[model samples]
Target: MKTGVLLVNLGTPTAPTAKAVKSFLSQFLHDHRVVDVPRMLWCPLLHGVILPFRSPKVARLYQSVWWPEGSPLMVISRRQQAALSEALDRAGIRMPVALGMSYGEPSMATAWEELKAAGVGRVIILPLYPQYSVSTTASVFDSWARLMKKERLVPAFRFIHDYHDHSGYIQALADSVRAHWELHGRGELLLLSYHGIPQRYQDEGDPYGLQCHRTSELVAAQLGLERHQWRTTFQSRFGREPWLQPYTDGTMQALPGEGIKRLDVICPAFSADCLETLEEIAEQNRSLFLAAGGESYHYIAALNDSPGHIQLLMDLVCRELA
Candidate 1:
C-alpha cells in the first residue's frame, strides 16, 4: 500500500514586507479557532485597524529574524521535512514526506497533491505542534477537512494529536540542554516557555497549557532539574485579553530583580526555530531580561531537524503506520 506523510506547521509570510505580512496575518487571524470574536466585530477591527497599523511593524519583526533563504520558520520546516524523509529511509520505510502550512505557501492542497501524485493510498497528518491547541492543531484539522470535503477519492488518513510527554521528545530536549550547558556552562535558571493562548480557550477546555506543563515537567525530570532550578512560562500572547500567564515578558523582567541573574530559556512548543523563538525570545526577551538587571541570558535553539528530533518524528510515523 502506498503511504505518505504530511508535516504541517503554522505558516509564514512569503516575504518580509507589510503587503505580505498583511496577507499572512489576514488569513491567520481570521481563523475562528484563532480569534473567537464574532466576524461582525472582528473583521473590521482586524482589517481596518490591526492589519493597517500592525503589519508594517510585524513585517520588521519578520525581517529581523528572516534567513537569507526565507523565513526562519519555513526554512527550518523544510529542513525538518527533508530530515524526516531521510530518517524514514534509514528505517527502511519508503514514503513521500511533504510540508503544508496552515495559512500560506506550500499549502495543504499543494502537499496533498504531492502525496496523491505519489499514488499514496494512506496519509498521516503530523502537525508540528507537539503540544496541541485549538488555535494551532485544530486549525490544521479544519484545513484538512475543507480539503477533503471536495475530494471524491479521499485517502485513508490518521492524525497524531499531541505528543507532549513523548519519551524520545523529552530526551531530545534534555540532550539539547546538556549540550548547551556543556558549551556555555549552566545558567542559574532554566525556563521552559511555550506559546500562549487566550485564557478563555483554556477555560473552554483546551489542553495546550496543561500539555506544555507536562512537556516541561518531563524534560525537567529527564535532566534531573530541581524545582528551583527550572520554571515554565508562556509567550507570544496577542491582544489585550488575558492569556495563560506567567507571561514570558513579565517573568523575564521580574526574574533578575528577584535575584535570578542568569537564565536559560527554551521554547518547547515550537519544534522549529521561528519568529517567536528566534526574535521574540532570543533578541527581544534577552534585551528585556538584561534591562531588568539580568547579567546572563541564553535562548536555547529549538529541536529543528536535529538527528534526535528526526528519529522522534520517524518513530511517530512508524508507530502510526504499525
Candidate 2:
C-alpha cells in the first residue's frame, strides 16, 4: 500500500494579532485533554475571563517573536517538513510528507487531503512532541480518529506515541548543546527546561513528566554531564494551580541567587522554537535571570531541521515503512 507521513506539531496562530491569537487560544484551551476542568466552571472562566485578558497580552508576546516570513513555529515547521521530505526522497522513499497543525491552519484535514491527492493508502502519524502527553500526542490521535470516522474508506494508520528515549534524539540534543558550547563558551549549569503539564496530570498517571525526566537524563549522560552540572526544570506553566517544578522562571531566578550566574537552557519538549522558546525562555526568562543578578544566560536552539534531526525523522519513517 502507498503510505504517506503526517508530521504534526501543537501549532501556532496564523498571525501575531489579538483576533488570531484569541481564535487560536480558544480552540487550544477549550480542549478537555489540555485544560481538564469541568466545562461548567471552565467555560465561563475561559470565555469570559481568560480569553479576554490573555488574548491581547499573548498577541503582544507573539509579536515580539514573529518572523517576517510568518509565525516562527510555522516557518520552522515548514522547513522541517521540506527537509524531512528531501531526506526521504534521498533514501528512495517516494511518499507524501505533509505538515499538520493540531490547532491552526494547514489542519489535519488539509494534510489528509494532500495525502489523498498523492494516492496515499496508508498514513504514519508522527507527532513532533518527543515526550508523549495525552494533552499533545493523544490530541493529535483524536484529530486523526475524527477524520477517519468521516471517511467512507479509512486508510491504514500507524501512530508514533513518542521518541523521548530514542538514541538518535539523545545524541542530537547532546550534539546541539556541544555545538552551542563550542561556538559560545560552556556555562556553569545546563538546564533542560521542558514545557510543563500540571502536576495533577502526573498524579493522575500521565507519563509526560516521567518521559521528560528520562529525556533529560539521557541527554545529560550523552554529554557526559555530572549530576551537579545539569538540572531538569519545567517551563511555560499555564494556570495558578500547581504544575511541574522547579518552575523554569523560578529556577532561573533562584540559580542567580544560588551563585550560578552563568547558565544555558534548552527545551527538550519543543521540536521548534516558538513563542515559548523564543520569547518566554530567551527573552523573558533571560531578563528574569539577569535582573536577579545572573551574569550570563544562553538559550540553546531546538533541533529544528538540523541534519541530525532530519536523519532522526528519516529513520523513524524508514522503520515504519520497512
Candidate 3:
C-alpha cells in the first residue's frame, strides 16, 4: 500500500479578528476532549459568556503576534510541512506528506483528502505535540477516526502518540538552546515551559504531565544544565481550573524575588511558535518578569523548520517507514 504522512497541529484563527477568533474558539472549546465539562452546563457559559467576552480579547492578542504571512503557527507549520517533504525527497524516500490543523482550514479531513488524491492508502499521523494529552493528540486521532467513519475504503493507519523523550528530539531541543545561548548569552536560569492541561486530567491517569517533565529532564541533561540551572513549568492554561503547577506566569513573577535576575524561557511543548509562545511567553511573561524585578529575559524560539528540527522529523518518518 502507498504510504503518506499527516502533520497535525492545534489550529489558529483564520484572521486576527473577533469574528474569526470566536469561530475558532467555538469549534476548539466545544470539543469534548478539550473542555470535558458537561455540554448542558458548558454550552450556555461558553456561548453566552466566554465566547462573547474572550473572543475580542484573544483576537487582540492574536493581532499582537500576527505575521504578514499569517499567524505564526500557521506559517511555521507550513514551513515544517514543506521542509519535511524536501527532507524525505533528499533521503530518496517516496511519500506524500500533508499538513492538517485540528480545528481550522486545511483541516484533518482535508489533509486526508490530499493524501488520498496523491494515491496514498496507508497513513502515518504524526501530531506535532511532543507530549500526548487526550485533549490534544487524542483529538487528532478522533479527527482521523471521523474521517475513516465517512470513507467507504478506510485507510490503513500508523499513529505516533508522542515523542517527548526521543533522542533526536531531545538533541534538537538542546542544540536550539545552545545556539540561542551562544548568540544571546546564557541566562542564570533556563525555564522550560510547556502548555498545561487541567490537574484533573493528570489525576485521571493522563501521562502528559509525566511525559512533559521527562522531556524537560532529557533536554536539560542534553544541554548539560545542572539542577539549579534549569526548571520546568507549565503555561497557557484556560478555565481557572488547577493546571499542572509551577505555572509559568507565576514562576516568572517569583523568580526575581529569588534573585534570579537573568532568565531564559522556552516552550518545548509547541513545535512552532504561536501566540502562546510568541506573545504570551516572549512579550507578556517577559514584561511580567521584568516588572517583578527580573532582568535579561529572553524567549528562545521553537524548533520550527530549523535544520535540527527538520532532521528530527526526517528521522521519525524514516524510522516509521523502515
Candidate 4:
C-alpha cells in the first residue's frame, strides 16, 4: 500500500517585515479558534488596531530569532521531517514524509497536494504538538478537513492527536533534561515551561493545561526529582485575557527572591526552539531572572532533531502506518 506522512507545526512569518508580519498575523489572529471573539468585534480590533499597532513589535521579535537559513520553527521542522524519513527508511519503511506549517508557508494545502501527487493511498498526519487542544490540534484537523473537501480522491487518514503519555516521548524529554543537568550541574529548581493558552479555552474543556502538567510530572518522575525540585508554568501569553498560570515570566522573576538562585528552564510545549523559546525564554526571560537577582539561569534547548526525539517520532509514524 502506498503511504505518506505529513508533519505540521505552527508557522513563522515569511520574513521579518511589518508587511509580512501583518499578513501572518491577519491569518493567525483571524482564526476564530485563536481569538474567539465574534467577527463584528474582533475584526476591528485585529485589522484596524492590533495589526497596525502590534505588527512592528512582533516583526522585531521575529527578527531577533531569525537565522540566515530561516525561522527556527521552519528550519527545525524540516530537519525533523528529514530525520523521520531517514529513520523510517533505515527501518525498511517506505513512505514519503512531507512537512507543513499550520499558519504560514508550506501550508497544509500544499502538504496535502504533495501527498496526493505521490499517489499515496493512505496518509498519516502528525501535528508536532505533544499535547492536544482544540486551539492547536483541532485547528490542524480543521485545515485538513477543509483541504479534503475539494479533493476528488481522499486517502485513508490517521491523525495522532496527542503523544503526551507516550513512553518514548517521555523518555526523550527526560533524557534531554538529564543531559542538560549533567553538563551544567543541577539547578536549585527545574522549570518546565509550556506555551500558554487562554483560561477560557480550558474552561471550555480544552485539555492542554492538564496534559502539560502530566508531561511535566512524567518527566520529573523519570528524573526522580521531588515536587520541590521541579514545577510547570505557562508562557507566551498576550493581551489582557487571563491565561494558564503560573506565568513563566512571573515565576522566573519571583524565583530569585524566593531563594531559588540557580534554575534550569525547558519549554516542553515546543518541539523546536522558536522565538518563544529562543528570544523569549533564553534571552528576554534570562535578563528578567538575572535582573531580579537570580544567581544563575539556564535555558535548556528543545528536542529538535535529537536522536531520541527522532526515534520517538519515527516510532509514532510507524505505528500509524502499521
Once fitted onto the true fold, the runs of candidate 3 whose alpha carbons sit more than 4 angstroms away are: none
**lDDT, candidate 3, at 166:** 93
lDDT of each: 0.94, 0.94, 0.93, 0.91
Q: How do the residues 1-322 of candidate 2 rate in per-residue lDDT, one tens digit apiece?
A: 8999999998899999999999999999998999989999999999999999999999999999998999999999999999999988888889889999999899999999999999999999999999999899999999999899999999988899899999999989999999999999999999999999999999989999999999999998899889999999998888799998889999888898789999999999999999999999999999999999999999999999999999998888888876
lDDT of 3 by residue, 131-213 (tens): 99999999998888988988999888889989999998999899989999899999999999999999999999899999999
Pick by lDDT: 2 or 4, better one: 2
What lDDT tens digits, residue by residue, belong to model 4 across residues 204-304? 89999999999999999999999999999999898898999999999988999999989999998899999899999999999999999998999999999
- Pairing residues by index, what is the TM-score of model 2? 0.99
Backbone clashes per model, in order? 0, 0, 0, 0
How far residue 116's Cα lies from its native spot in candidate 2, in Å, is 0.7
- Note the residue pairs that clash in candidate 2: none
